[model samples]
Target: MPTVIALTRFGPPEVLRPLRIETPRPGPGQALVRIRAAGVNPVDCKLRRGDFAGTDPAGFPQRLGNEFAGTVVALGPDVPADGAVAVGADVVGSATAQAYAEVLVVDTAGLVVKPPPVPWEMAAGLPAAGQTAHTALSQLGVGPGDVLLIHAAAGGVGTIATQLACELGARVIGTAGEHNHDYLRSLGATPTTYGPGLLDRVRALAPDGVDVVLDLVGGEAVTTSLALVQDRHRIGTTVDRRAVEEHGVLRVGGRSLPALREIVGKAATGRLTLPVRTFPLREAVAAHRLVESGHVRGKVVLTV
Candidate 1:
């Protein structure tokens, strides 16, 4: 039997409990991984609180966590010899609400080879935030000469996006608290304090105007982005769905294997970096509380 963290019912972080279950076997085109680390995301907390119950209701004892880094223990039937991952290979991938377990099965097509230089904690944290940031930048056509404004730039997704955009030759203007301003600068962004007169502060930095916006914080952030950038299509949100329907602003990000590999490579070569806070697997509840507090500088991970 393998242990997994699951929510016995929809509620707060306290609902999360450990359960012993039969080890899952891989199906065709899948692989069984012995998970080394799992990332704690805001979505995991939301799902636990039944935030998306109408669309993605959870069954009792439902697992949490969407991304993980681990080693392949077994390959399923018909897995290609030249596939992206192989048995005994170190890998990282996204999962469907099941990465919290000690061992789990995942489709081979979605896994990326984890480079030797990348640590387990960083690899586990990369998939969701990395892919989302990569996809968002691609959607906004962020590149050379583009001035991109990123809200919540010191957070998980924003940190990666800032570095990636800078690597792509874009000038990044990132919004964070005064405390994280210097931190954002280290990641290649011109950091600005986010709150009260945010528009004016950004204007002072980029007099020509911002070409694109990636909003990780909704409400006022989206409103501020609309005021700064004229093109609705160039403005996107990962947190605000209401703004999408109301303003026709683009909703960015989807699972991308290529993006994952690219980010992993950058991280391996020291071109990209992610600050991580780690906890043992049983402390998932405490991790959830920290994430829910909304003040973590970077990513939070569970060591399994």
Candidate 2:
């Protein structure tokens, strides 16, 4: 039997409880991974609270977690023909609400090799935030000479997006609290305090006007982006679906294997970095609370 953390019901962090279940066997084109670490995301908390119940209703004892890093313990039928991954290989990738367990099965298509130097905690945290940031920047056409404004720049997705934008030669202006200003600057972003007067402050940083905006915080952040960036297509949001429907701002986020490999390669070569806060697997409730608090500077992970 293997232990998995599941939400007995949709409510709060306390609903998450450990359950012992039979180990899952891989199907065709799948691999069974002994999970080393799992990432805790804001969406996990949302799902627990039934935030997306209209579209993605939960079944009782549903698992939580979308990304993980671990070692391949076995491969299913027809899995090793391409030679991309094999038994005992270290890998990282996106999972579907099932990464918060000791062992789980994943499609080979979604897994990428985790570099030797990248720690399991960081690798686990990378998949969701890394892919989201990469996709958002690509959607916004962030590249050389572009001035990118990133809301909530000190948080998980924003941190990766800021570094990736800088790597792509964009000038990044990131919004964070005053406490995280120095931290954002270290990641190659011009940090601005987010709140009351954010538009004016960002304007002061980029007098020519922002070329694009990646809004991780909705509401005022989207409103600020509308005032600062002229083109709606160049504005994107991961949080505000309403704004996307109303203002035509791009909705960004889809996992790409190429993007995952690229980010992992950068991390391996010391070109990209993500800080992670770790807890043992049983402390998933604590991780959820930290994420829900909305003040964590980086990502949180559960070690199994």
Candidate 3:
């Protein structure tokens, strides 16, 4: 048996409890992984709090977590024994609702190689945020000379998006807390604190005007972006469904294996950085609380 954190019932972080489950065996095209680290994402918190209660059909005791990094402990019968995903290969991937466990089965196709230079913690943090940032930038067509405005730029996805935008030759203006402003600048973004005076601050930073806006924080940020950029198509968001429906700003963030692979490669060479706050697997309640706080500098992860 392996212990996994499961929702006893949807409520606060206290609702999460460790439950023992029968060790899962992989079927064809799947592999059994012994998880070393799992990323704690905001969506996991949303699910636990029943944010999507009406539309989500999952019952009680549902598992949380979408990204993980670990070692392949066993391979399915049909999986090639000598392939890149062998018995002892270290790997990382998105495993919807299943990564917060000691062991779990996942499709081999979703796994990306964890390079020697990338630590288990960083590898675990990359999948969801990396894919989301990459896809969002692609959807926005970010490129040379574009001034990209990233709201909540100190968070997991924002941290990666800031670096990727700079890599694409764009000038990134990231908004975070006063403390995180310096951190954003180190990643090649012009930093500004988000709030009442945001519009004026951004105007001063990029006097030529912002070419694109990627809003990670909803609410006022959406309205702020609307005023800065003229083309609604150039304004995108990972949050704010209401804004998408009413204002026609593009909704971003989706799975992209190629993008995940590219991100992992960059992280391996030190071209990318994703700071993580680690907690023991059994301390999942604390991890969930941290993610729900909305003030995490980088990423929060559970070490299994």
Candidate 4:
């Protein structure tokens, strides 16, 4: 049996509990991994709390985790054994919703070799956030001379997006609390406090006006971006669905394999950084609660 973090019912963070289940075998083009760390994402918390529509209660004991870092233990038929999928190879990759366990199977196509220099906690945290940042920036055509605004810019996705934007020769204006402003500055973003008069503050920073906006915090953030950037197609939101429907703003964010590979390579050379807070796997409740707190500096991870 393998122990995994699962929700016995949909509710608060407390709903996440450990369950024992038979270890899953890899199918063709898949690899079995012994997870060393799993990334605890915001979506996992949302699903557990039943915040997202269309969740069925019949899916109780549902697992929650989309990214993990570990070592390959076995390969399924048709998985090439000479590469990152080989047994004993350390790897990191995305999953569906089954990563928060001691062992689980994931598609071999998703796996990237974990550079020895990257710690397990950091590697576990990369795939989802890194890919989302990469995809959103590309979709928005973020480029040189552009002034990009990223809401909630100190969290997981924002952190990655800020650095990637800078790498693309774009100037970044990142919104965070006063406390995180200095941290955002370290990432090459012009930091501004987000709240009342956000538009004025951003206008003060970029008198020429913003060229793009990536909203991680919903509500007024989208409204603020709408005011700063004239191109509706350049304004994107990862969290707000209503704003997308009502305002026609692009709903942006998703995983990309090529993006993750590039991000991992940058991380390997000490270029990208994502600070992590870790807890033992059994403390997934605490992990979820911390993420739900909405103030974590970078990312949260469960160490197995």
Strongest candidate by lDDT: 3
lDDT of 2 by residue, 1-304 (tens): 9999998878888899999999888999999999999999999999999998999776788998999999999899878745868888999999989999999999988999998999999999999999999988998899999999999998889999999999999999998888899999999999998889988998898998899999999999999999988899999999999999999999997798899999999999999999899999999999999999888787999999
Instruction: In angstroms, give how far residue 1 of model 3 lies from its true place.
Output: 1.2
Q: Which stretches of model 4 miss by more than 4 angstroms?
A: 53-58
RMSD of 4: 1.1
Candidate 2 similarity to native, TM-score: 0.98
Which regions of candidate 3 deviate over 4 angstroms?
A: none
The per-model lDDT (C-alpha) reads 0.93, 0.92, 0.95, 0.92
Model 2: residue 171 alpha-carbon error in angstroms: 1.0
Off by over 4 Å in 2: none
Q: What local lDDT does model 1 show for residue 231?
A: 95
Could you say which candidate leads in TM-score?
Answer: 3
Q: What C-alpha RMSD separates each model from the true structure?
A: 1.2, 1.1, 0.7, 1.1
Cα lDDT of model 1 by residue, 182-248, tens digit? 9998999999988899989999999999999999999999999999888999999998999999998
Error of 4 at 54 (Å): 3.1
TM-score of each: 0.97, 0.98, 0.99, 0.97
lDDT of 4 by residue, 208-273 (tens): 989999999999999898888888999999999998999989989888888999999999999999
Task: For model 2, give the RMSD to the true fold.
Answer: 1.1
Over 173-203, each residue of candidate 3 has an lDDT whose tens digit, in order, gives 9999999988998999999999999999999
At residue 132, what lDDT does model 3 achieve?
98
